[model samples]
Target: MGHRLADTSSPARLAAPDEGIGRDELALATRNHGLPLEALRYDVTPPGLHYVLTHYDIPYVPDDTAWRLSVTGRVQRPLHLDLADLKGFPQVTTRVTLECAGNGRALLTPRPVSQPWLVEAVGTAEWTGVPLRLLLAAAGVDADAVDVVFTGADHGVERGVEQDYQRSLPIDVATGTEPEVLVAHAMNGAPLPPQHGRPLRLIVPGWYGMAHVKWLREVAVTDAPFTGFQQSVAYRLRQESGEEGEPVTRIVPRALLVPPGFPDFMSRARVVRPGTVPLEGRAWSGRAPVTRVDVSTDAGRTWREAELEPDDGRPWAWRRWHFGWTAAEGEYELSARATDAEGHTQPLQQPWNRGGFANNLVQRVPVLCLAKEG
Candidate 1:
C-alpha cells in the first residue's frame, strides 16, 4: 500500500521567518504541525491519530510491488522476502508501546539539546507481522554472529554524518522468545502509515522507539557489533563532555496521570471541584510487567498504591492504572510512579545525562482543588 503525506497546510508546516529559526522556534513549529507531545494522556491512542516524529522531513513511500526485505551478512542462506512472502509466514499480532529514546529531553535541567520532547513521544499500537526470528532462522544465522543490524529506507545527514537510519541488537535479543520482535508490515490491523515504517519496519517490543527501525529494507547479521552512527553516536547516552555513558534500551518504568482539563488553562493543568475524582493513566516497563503503580497528591512526600488493570498478556504492552482521590479546596501537585515486576520503580528525579536520553522521572501535574460552583 502507498503512503500518504501529511498535509503541508497544517500549522506545523508554517515557514520560518527570514532570519532563520532558532531551536526553540523550530520546536514550536514542529509541535504545531507534528504529533502532540502529550498524546499518552489519553486512555487509548487511536492508531490513525497516533503521534508521528521522523528523523527526516520527508517520509519514504516504497512501491509495494517492488519492495523487498533483504537478509544478508553472516547468514548461511541469504534471502529476500517481498511483502507477500513476508505475510505468508505464520503471522502474529501484538499490542506494544513505543516511546522515543529522548521522550523527556525538553524537561532536562541543562536546557535542550536534541528534539525538545515533553513526554508526548509515545503510543501503543496493535502490530501485525512475522516474527524476526523466523526470518533469521530461515536465513540460518552464522555461528559467530554477534549483532543483527536493521537498516531503514530513510536517509539524511544528521550531525554531519550522512547515512541511512540504522540500529542493532545482540543476536539473542533480536531473536528472543519473549517480547516477540517482529518485521511489522501493519499497525493497528492496517498497512502502516508512511510516517510509521510503511512497507516494513522492525518492532523491538519493550525497547525504545529508536530500536524499532522504520522503513525497513534490510536485516543484516554481523559477526561483530555494528557501529553505525545511530548506534555509536546519536542514541547512546553520554555523561560529562566525553564519557560514553551507555546505550539506551528498554522502556523505563513510568506512570502518567491523565489530568482533568481545567478551564482557561492547559487541559493538563485543570481546576477540579473539591470531591472524589478518578485518577487514571497508563504505566509500562521494558524489563518486566508493571506490577504496581503509586499516586501522590502532595508531590512525593507521600504515595498510595493505585489499582493496576489486568495485563493483556503481551509482555511488551502497557497496563492501565487508576486511583481514586478525595480532593479538598487547595492547590496540589499530583504525581504518579510505577514499579515493574523486577522491583524497579520510577525515580522521583532522574539523573541528567549529556544526551538527555531515558528521562523516566515521575510525572507531576499541577491541579487546583476548587469548591463546587453555585
Candidate 2:
C-alpha cells in the first residue's frame, strides 16, 4: 500500500486529567478497530471480525507471485525465497489468541494518548504457515546470533523516528518451541487479507500483537539487541517519563463478560429480565492457562466462581466460562476477573504505564434489571 508518514513529530503524552479524547487519538482510533465485546462468543474469530492495529498503511501486494522473503545477516546461507519456496517447508496451523498491548488505555485516569482502546482489542484464529524455527535452521543461523530482526515492508514514522516497521526476537525465543513462532501465510485457512499482512506475516503465539510483524520483507540474524524505535523507545511500560521501562511482552491474564441482555442502542448498557440469567464470557493468559474465573454482580464487592469450560487443548487460545445469576429489578454493576495457572490474576484497578502497554484491568458493565409484565 501507499505509505503515509506523520508530517510532524507525534510522540506519546497523557491527556489532561479532565480532558476527553483528542482528535489525534481519534484519528488513530479510526485507523485501528477493536473486537466487539460480543464477538467473544465465537470460538474462531472470523477474519473480518478480528481486531487490527496497523502502525502504518497496509502494504499492497497486487500479485503474490512477486513477493519475496529474504533471510540474511550472520547466517551460513542467505535465503531469497518467494511464496512457492516457503510453502515447500512442512506446514503447521496454530490457533492463537492475539491481543493488543494497549487494550485498556482509555480507562486509565490520565489516559496515555495512543490507541485509546477500551479492553476490546483482541481476537483468535487458526494461522497456517511454516514454523519459523525451520526457516532459521535452513538459513543455518550463526552460533553467536543474539537476535533476529524482522522488517515489514510498511514504513512510517513514530515519535519522530522514521524507519521501516521492525521488531526483533531474542535467539532463544526465535528458535524455541515453547511459543513456536510461525512465518504465517494464511489466516483461518485462507490467504491473509491485505490488512492482516497479505502474502506473509509472523505469528508469535503468546506475545502481544506487535511482536507478530505484518507484511514481512526481511529477516536478519544479528549479534546485537535491536534498538529500533518500536523495540526500544516504544511498547514499554514506564510509570513516569524517561525510564528504560520494562519491555512489554506476553499478554496478561484477563476476563471479559458478554453484556447480559439486550442493549439500549445509544448507551450500550444492558437490560435484562428479573430472574435467573446466564452469564458467559472468555478468559485467557499468555503466562499460563486460566485456572479460574470469578464473576462479580455487585461491583466486585462479592465474587462467585464461574464454571470454566473444559480446556479445548489450545493453550494459547482464550477459554470460555459461564455463571448463572439471579436478578432483581434494580440497577447493578457487573464485573469479571481471571486467574491463570501461573498464579497471576487481573487487578481490579488497572496498573498504569507510560506507553499504556499490558493494562489488564477488570471489566465493569452497568446493567438494569427489569421485570417483564403482562
lDDT of each model, Cα atoms only? 0.79, 0.92
CA displacement after TM-score superposition, residue 59 of candidate 1 (Å)? 2.8
Tens-place lDDT per residue, model 2, 275-352, is 988999999999998999999999989999999997677999999999999999999999999999989999987798
| Model 1 residue-pair collision total | 3
- C-alpha positional error of residue 275 in candidate 2 after TM-score superposition, expressed in Å: 1.4
Query: Which run of 10 residues does model 1 get worst, by summed lDDT?
Result: 7-16
Error of 2 at 257 (Å): 1.4
Q: When superposed on Cα atoms, how far off is each prediction in RMSD? A: 6.4, 2.6
**Which portions of model 1 miss their true places by more than 4 Å?**
1-21, 24-44, 261-268
- Name the candidate that leads on lDDT: 2
Over 1-374, each residue of candidate 1 has an lDDT whose tens digit, in order, gives: 55323222111122223433456447644752323424555445676556566776445564776898999999999999899999899999888888877776666676435566666667889999999999999999999999999989888766666678889999999889887899999988889887788878999899988999998999999999889988887777676545665899888887876775454444546688988888888888988899999999998899999998998566677788889998989888988999988998877877577677788888778888887787
RMSD of candidate 1 to the true fold?
A: 6.4
The C-alpha stretches of model 2 lying farther than 4 A from their native spots are 1-7
Q: Residue 243 of candidate 1: its Cα lDDT?
A: 60
